[model samples]
Target: MEVFIRHQDKNKRKEEAVNFFIEHKTNSYISHSEIMSGRAKSTTEWSENFADILSAELDEDDCNLITIEDIHNKIIGIAILRIYRKYLIIEDMIVDGSLRGMSLGKKLMDFIHNFAAEQKIKALFLESGINNDKAHSFFEKNGFEKVSVTYIKTLSE
Candidate 1:
């Protein structure tokens, strides 16, 4: 399938991209039991909050929302890159779960790399959830190294 990668048109595509992502959201490859044991807020509230945060990032001057589309103009993937003092951080990236084995992700990474080069960024950074082995492998294969482990503690209010 022919794919086009470009800066996301916030007005035209943000909502569609967000919906697609929420539908396919994963626990980063965690086991079923682990996922079941985890503390998750009401799905409705979580999704609402996520959408708001994502929208805000898209509106930020230092963030670029990149999207990939099929020839039919359907959005297949979305990525948000935030510029920082030392590197370009990939805040979020999601590809349609139905298109898993396809090379759309590699294409998106190549696009990001090229964009970073153009902006003279010396390094790129991102974090994959602790249990997301598929994501870990993909990132490793794409030349990302395991530099640190992020710890998380869910607090109850």
Candidate 2:
């Protein structure tokens, strides 16, 4: 499969990415029980707000939105990076579960690294679900070391 990695900050693209993320959240990794468990925090509303904020931030040069399109020109993966005072964080990383293992994920990652080097970013940090072993393995295979364990507890549950 041929994939093209693109670095662009367009609203249409950002919305496409956000929609894809929310679509996955609704079905794949999250169950209804888990969704209800986080209702007190209004996780869904917060996520919607976040996507809006992120979409609005696309115009900033320090924020980036990246996507990978297959030969058909359909976006199969997307990632977003944000630069802060001390670190460059990959805030979003998703490859359509159907399209995993075709190296597109790694290609997008490489693009981020090259872009970061140009931006003179020194350190990088990323967060991923410890439940997603495939994602963890991919990051580990790409030279990301275990930084620290993150714990999450829900008060409403």
Candidate 3:
């Protein structure tokens, strides 16, 4: 299937993007730190606030909200990227759950790679939930290395 990746026009596509995100949020996870800090107790809670967060990011200069669409112009994937001095961080990335096995995710990653290369960014970084082995495998297959492990300890208040 042919798909195109582009920077999302928030004014025109925010709602569609949010809806698509909500639909696929189940495939994502809330980090242990988020849960321990009460920022979000679950993926559902985290995703419930996605619309507002996405809106804020859309207005940020260093944040890029990208969307991948099919030939029919339907949003099939979304990614939020934050550009830093030497690295581009993928804050969130989701491809339509129904279409998982397809090469769409790789296409999105390729787009990100080119975008970073064009901007002369040195590296790309992202984190996935510890238990998300499938996502880990996918990232590895797409040339991402397991660079670091994040450990969280809930402090007593």
Candidate 4:
């Protein structure tokens, strides 16, 4: 399939990209706070909040919402990137669940790498959920290294 990668047009594509994120987030593990608050009980409940955060990020100067689309103009993959002076952080990346194992994810990563290089950025960074082995393997295959482990402790309410 012929696919094109480009920066998302916030006005035209924010909703579609947010919907894609909601659908594919099933692969992600719920956070401790979400579990404690019972917001993880249903995808429908927290999706609105998730949508709001994602939409706002798309409008930020440092955040770049990159999207990949098929020839038919359907969005197939997305990456939420935060660019810094010396490095770029990929906050989130998702490829259509139905299209897994198709290397679309690799295409998006390659695009990010090229963009970073053009800006003279020296490194790329991202964190994946500890339980998402599939994503860890994919990141390794794409040349990402495990630089550090993130530990979080939820404070009592």
Off by over 4 Å in 4: 27-48
The 10 consecutive residues of candidate 3 with the worst lDDT sum are 34-43
Each candidate's TM vs. the true structure?
A: 0.84, 0.75, 0.85, 0.86
Candidate lDDT scores, in order, read 0.75, 0.69, 0.79, 0.78
Residue-by-residue lDDT tens digits, candidate 1, 34-99: 223332243212333666655665676887888989999888898889889768998778899889
- lDDT per residue as tens, model 4, 35-153: 43443433223544666666776777777889999999999999988877798988778899889888899899999999999988989988766677888899999888898875566
lDDT of 2: 0.69
Cand. 4 Cα-lDDT: 0.78
Better of 1 and 2 by lDDT: 1
lDDT of 1 at 120: 90
Q: Mind giving the per-residue lDDT tens digits that candidate 3 earns over 76-156?
A: 999988888989999778898889889888999999999999989999999887777778888999899998887766457
Model 1 misses residue 92 by how many Å? 0.9
Q: Count the backbone clashes (under 3 Å) in each candidate.
A: 1, 0, 0, 0
- Candidate 2 on 29-87: residue-level lDDT in tens? 33223234341124233343545554555656777788888888777888878889767
How should the candidates be ordered by lDDT, best one leading? 3, 4, 1, 2
Q: Assess candidate 3 and give its TM-score to the true structure.
A: 0.85
